[model samples]
Target: MPTARWRKSSYSGGQGGECVEVANVAAVIAVRDSKDPAGPKVTLTASGWCDLARRIKSGEHDLI
Candidate 1:
């Protein structure tokens, strides 16, 4: 597979937090930890990624 073009989350500034990076790799969406580029990653389908994004935006999985 070709190398993914990663895009870092804007919310991840210089401050310390769970930094995330996302990329579009062919038919799948690739996700990884910005702090651990060489570590394990997760790949999800386009529909699955959209569902997850929708859930997150609607606060359906927010923990406080």
Candidate 2:
């Protein structure tokens, strides 16, 4: 497979705490930790990605 061109979130700070990188891998959205490029990844379909984004914006998964 070709290498994914990952991009970090614009909201991420330079100090890097916890950050994720996303890439478009054909029919799916690929996500990985920016601190661990060679680590595990999470893949989601287009619709699934949209749903997750919507839920996040709605604070459904807020930690506080």
Candidate 3:
């Protein structure tokens, strides 16, 4: 079972349809939707989260 805490993204500004919930689970990062807290989620490795953070910071990925 996954025991992760989730919340709105800082970038969301409290409004966004594509908003996601993030959790710092042990050795992994779990992501889910704020709208559906009890819904399915995806787990990523620490390195994966780091890479994603890098990309987002560098504006490598197109965001809405």
Alpha-carbon lDDT of model 2: 0.89
TM-scores, all models, native as reference:
0.82, 0.90, 0.71
Provide the lowest-lDDT 10-residue window in model 2. 1-10
Error of 2 at 58 (Å): 0.9
Candidate 1's error at 48, in angstroms?
0.5
Best by lDDT: 2
lDDT of 2 at 1: 20
In model 2, state the lDDT of residue 64: 92
* Candidate 1 C-alpha lDDT tens digits along 1-64: 2478988777777763478888999999998887888888899999999999999889999997
A best-first ranking of the candidates according to their lDDT comes to 2, 1, 3
lDDT of 2 at 36: 84
lDDT of all the models against the reference?
0.85, 0.89, 0.79
Error at 2, model 3, angstroms: 6.6
State the local distance difference test value for candidate 1.
Answer: 0.85
- The TM-score between candidate 1 and the true structure equals 0.82
Q: How many Å off is the CA of 22 in candidate 3? A: 0.7
Against the correct fold, how does model 3 do in TM-score? 0.71
